[model samples]
Target: MLNIAIAQLNYTVGDFTSNVAAIIGGMRTAFARAADIVVFSELAVCGYYPGDLLEDAAFLEQFEPALEKLLEASRQMPKLATVVGTVRRNTGAGKPLHNSLLVIQDGIIIAEYHKQLLPTYGIFDEYRHFEPGQQTACTLRIAGHHIGFLICEDGWNQPGRDYKINPFDALRRAGPELVISINASPSDIAKRTLRHSTLGKAAADTGLPILFVNQVGGQDQLVFDGASFALMPDRRIVFEAEQFSEDFQLIAFDEGNFTAAGGAALPIPSQGLSTEEFARRQIILGVQDYARRCGFSKAVVGSSGGIDSALTLALAVQALGAENVAAVTMPSGWSSEGSVSDSQTLCANLGIPLYVHPIASLVQQYGAGFKDAFAAPLQGLPLENLQARIRGTVLMEYSNSFGALLLTTGNKSEISVGYCTLYGDTNGGLGLIGDLYKTEVYALSRHINLQAGRELIPEAVISKAPSAELAPGQKDTDSLPPYEVLDEILKWHLEGRRMPQTEADAAYGFVQQLQAGDEGRQLVKRILGMVARNEYKRRQAPPLIRVRARAFGSGRQMPIAAKY
Candidate 1:
């Protein structure tokens, strides 16, 4: 039997001092638990997805000291073996570095394993920085058992797939008693289920008990949920860690079975959190981590009392606390009474202060100035956009003076169709609900109210029609389709390929039915055209917390000034 500790941790990218400190601290905790070995998530030393920082010589120079620190710490706990991820100089003709795992015991490096599968699709661009390591199964003997190692993407190459190499196949042939896989996998709608299915099948096929560790917390647009788990040879998950948060656990592995710390049988949940719960946890962690990492403790949101802004404020308060989150209603001449009153009610309910900053005067000045400078009246669509820009500027002033991070309130539906104003309503340091479709925003709002067991986000706010409130009697339906229809259309156009099979099939059927009619077909064409034309606006928008399978920022790449 081998006693093992899984450290599912959060790491700051390129902050080696904190990263090393965390690793050392975890090692001490593992030793105290009387475990033979402790495993950390992928790239825990420097955090995951460091992007081009891997090419910097100065950045890479600090890694040796960090590694030395880990090595030195391992000497104190001579009986404890530590498996950690770090970048190592490749010293070959191809890439400059390799993503590697180092095993240390008794202050000596026992074995080194390099990642074989470097994913380059979607948000991953591993091929740009690190070269693939030579194909091999690395096994180490510890406590009368042989253990194998695999990095994040290394174990993903299942047999009968198109990939030329399967590391699991090689590792299984090498006959290890167990396999340990470390990952920095990001969270999405179906990510946890996908990981469970993939790893569960691998364990069943190889007849090897598997321990998986993952990193948690938000780094820019990506949030990694730490749903780390251990699987038996029969594909049964015996032990699991907390989801969307940092978790640490020690387990015993013997006879292809996993037990809790001190050899007690582990009780595991058969199903994970509901979809709404998963998204809620993911966004909250994303907001909290992003704020802390970017050196802000407080957040400021331009609240229009619409669903998007209401949900954004609620989430910000949930992550940063009501005292740390403030909402400002920058109302204009066209702003409705409920826009301000509902915002006031919502903020009061949550115990947060609300600031009423009317933008009517500012809008008048901008209109007059535009007429003077451009020799034409800034009326019609430009005039309405001017109101949004004035409000955005006011919010920016608050953010700058108060040193609070600005949270943009645009939902995925508006963002997709270019219904938002760039340099206006789209201005922020980060977007709280930008990844959620309009319908999902409403659903999350209701979910939040249900979770709170009351109308924390005022009933008026939830029932009100969503609008920019920049023009007289403006309604979203006046410019775009109803949210129910628009969200479906956007889902089909933007995330069709990545959507769930049932959803994708449904979206396909809906689009086909729409194409049968001229008006519906033209509506689809116009929405697609809007999406294509708005790439530049999205390119300039702040990083949105990704909660879906395909989000705007890095997940989807499109050319702004090109025709499809």
Candidate 2:
């Protein structure tokens, strides 16, 4: 029997002091449990996806000392072997570094394995810095079991993925009794469930019991949920860790069976958090880690008393305490009374401070200045955009003076159709709800209020119609199709084959029905055109906390000057 401790920890990027301490702390915890081996997530030393930080000479130099510290720490528990993910220099050709996995016992480096698959698409640019490792498998004998190693992307090459090399197959052929796969998998809407189905299939086919560990926490726009688990050869997830938070636990493996460390049974859930709960948790962790990493404990939101900003403010208060969240309503001459009153009501419901900063005077000053300078009256769309820009400027001033991070409130529906002002509402340092469609935004608000068993977001804010308040009698429907119809069209066009099969089928069916009429067809075509034309605006917008599988940022990259 082999006792393995799986450490799913949140590591700060480039913070060698803290990361080294965390790795050592995990080792100590495993040693106290009398475990034979301890496994950590991929790139646990310096954190995953360090981006261009690896290019800096000084940054790369910091790893050697960190590795030495880990080796020194291992000497204290000679019977305990640890597998840690770190980076090593590639001496010969190609890129200069290799994403490496090291096995350390008694302060000695026993075995080493490099990640063979380097993903380059969709928020991954590993190929840009590290060389693809050679096709091989590394297995070590410990506690009467042969344990094979795989880095994050190594085990993901299943049958139809079209990758040239499959590391899991190689490890299986090597005849290891157990496999330890380390990952830094990010948490999206369906990612956790997808991981279970895909990896469970691999385990069943290979006929090997597998132990998976993942890093947790947020790094910029990405959030890693640490739902590490052990899969039996029969495709049953016997033991699992927590999600969206750090967890360390011990599991016993004997004769291809897994149990708790003390030989007790383990209960694994058949399903994880629901879609709405998953989105809520992902956004909360993303926002919390992003604000903490960027050196801000407080956040400010430009509340519009509409669903988007209301949801944004509600989420902010959940992440940072109500005392740490501030709301400001900048209503203009065209704004409705609900804009101010609803914002105040929502803030009061959440127990956060609310400030009213009317932007009608600022809008007039900007319009007059434009007319005097260009000898032309600023009217029509330009005037509306000017009002948005003025509000954006006021938000920036408040942010600079108050030392609080601004949270943008644009939803994916508005962001997709280019209905948002780039320099205005988009002036925040980070966005809380940009990935959620307008419909999802409303769903989340209601979910929050329901979960709280009270009106945390105020019913008036959620029930009111959405508008920019930039023009008289302005409503979102005045220019765009109803959200019910428009959301389906955007989902079909933007998500396409990436969405779940059932959802894709429904969206496709709805879009096909809409094509029966000329007006509906033209509306879909116009929305698609707006999405493509707004690439430049999205390219410059602040980073948004990603909750969906395909977000607007690096997950769905597009060219600014492309035709298709």
Candidate 3:
């Protein structure tokens, strides 16, 4: 019988000691089970996106000891063949490092494989660091079965675009009986089915069982969902590992049939859940891990009646629970009755305590103090910004007083174009929804209620127009295009990586409106200008849970001063 284990874990970038320790623990468990092999996610030791830190000499110095420690630990598990992802260095005249999966056995480095497909477009820049691998894949004999291996990005292939040659083809050339893949492939609603089909097809065509392993949890804007699995030679799923979690799985293959044997078989945390529902789980875990990793127990947020704050509060309540969450309702004069009602309703629904503190009195007091400057009518963005700043001040004050981390809740759509007040609405310990768009936020809310078969967020809240409510008769659409229209353009520009002209003419007829006249240009200018300018704000915002493969934080690095 052939035994395999998957280590789906939440690994922080540059946290070498912790990552190494986790690998050791996993190896021990895999050995105790008498498994011949244990697999981990790509770049598991250094987190997925270490960015340019792999180039830093000082960090490399700090990384060396972890490798020795890991190797020493692997020696203790001589019976287990371990294939774990990590940065492997080459101290030669060139070739700085490789994003490699190290194969260790019998107290020696059995083999190593560098990723051949160095994704250069969108959020990846693997091409910038390590050199692409050139060696043909080989089979490893373990437990009397020949096992093949492939790294993340090795299996993904899109038609039309030139894709790197398949490494698994070369690996399968040796006629292996089983294939093991390690991945840090990030989460995407569209990509999930493709992942399963791809691995299953590989297993069926090659007549081998494929065990797929992936990373989990949120680091910056990228969330790695760990729906690790095993595909039988007949292309049927025999095992589905947990998703959006740190987990382990065990599978056995004998007599040309595979069965899930042990290692905590749980329903994938996110399957068929709407993007937001999945994202909510991802963000809650993101916040929970971020707070725990940074050494904090509780979190606090300002709960306005707005969708952003409501969703943020829901996530906090779910993540840290009602006992550890505190919501402060700081309302200004422009705040509507519905807004206050929604906030209170959501607090009760989530079972969290709410503190109602009217900011009108504070605003009035500030007005009295600045009577000279406030003698004239308060107008434009400055006045609108002041109210937001006031709320930020109160939330931070509470954070300091209670030692609770503050979670900022700005959606990707808002953060993309400077719809947020920099130090005001942007002030917090982390931006929970900073990677998600406005439309995505609503979808996620609906998914959550649907999943629970009850309304956690009110039906009116979902149906109502979104607003900051800092000004009378305020609505997001009053300043920006409708979310449907805006999200379409954003998906084209951001995800499709295309300019306006590149989009289908009918799908993007708004270009004509944008170029029609001064008013058009001005509105487009406002939207585009905010998007371009807000890079700085996103750069400073606290780390958020990344539900997508590409989010605004570390996964995507744009020049704050660049003109798009």
**Which residue pairs collide, candidate 2?**
none
Question: How many clashing residue pairs are found in candidate 2?
Answer: 0
Off by over 4 Å in 3: 56-58, 62-64, 157-165, 198-209, 232-236, 255-257, 261-272, 364-377, 452-454, 497-530, 533-540, 555-564
Superposition TM-score, candidate 2 onto the true structure: 0.98
From the highest lDDT down, the ranking of the candidates is 2, 1, 3
Give lDDT tens digits, candidate 1, residues 345-371.
899878899998887888888888988
Q: Model 3, 197-262: lDDT tens per residue?
A: 777676666677777888887665566778888777686776777777788877777666666655
Candidate 1 regions with alpha-carbon error over 4 angstroms: 159-162
Global CA lDDT of candidate 3, please? 0.77
lDDT per model, in order?
Answer: 0.89, 0.89, 0.77
Q: For all the candidates, what are their Cα RMSDs to the real structure? A: 1.3, 1.2, 4.3
Q: For residues 106-140, write the lDDT of model 2, one tens digit per residue.
A: 99999998889999877888999999888989999
Ranking by TM-score: 2, 1, 3
The TM-score of predicted model 3 comes to 0.85
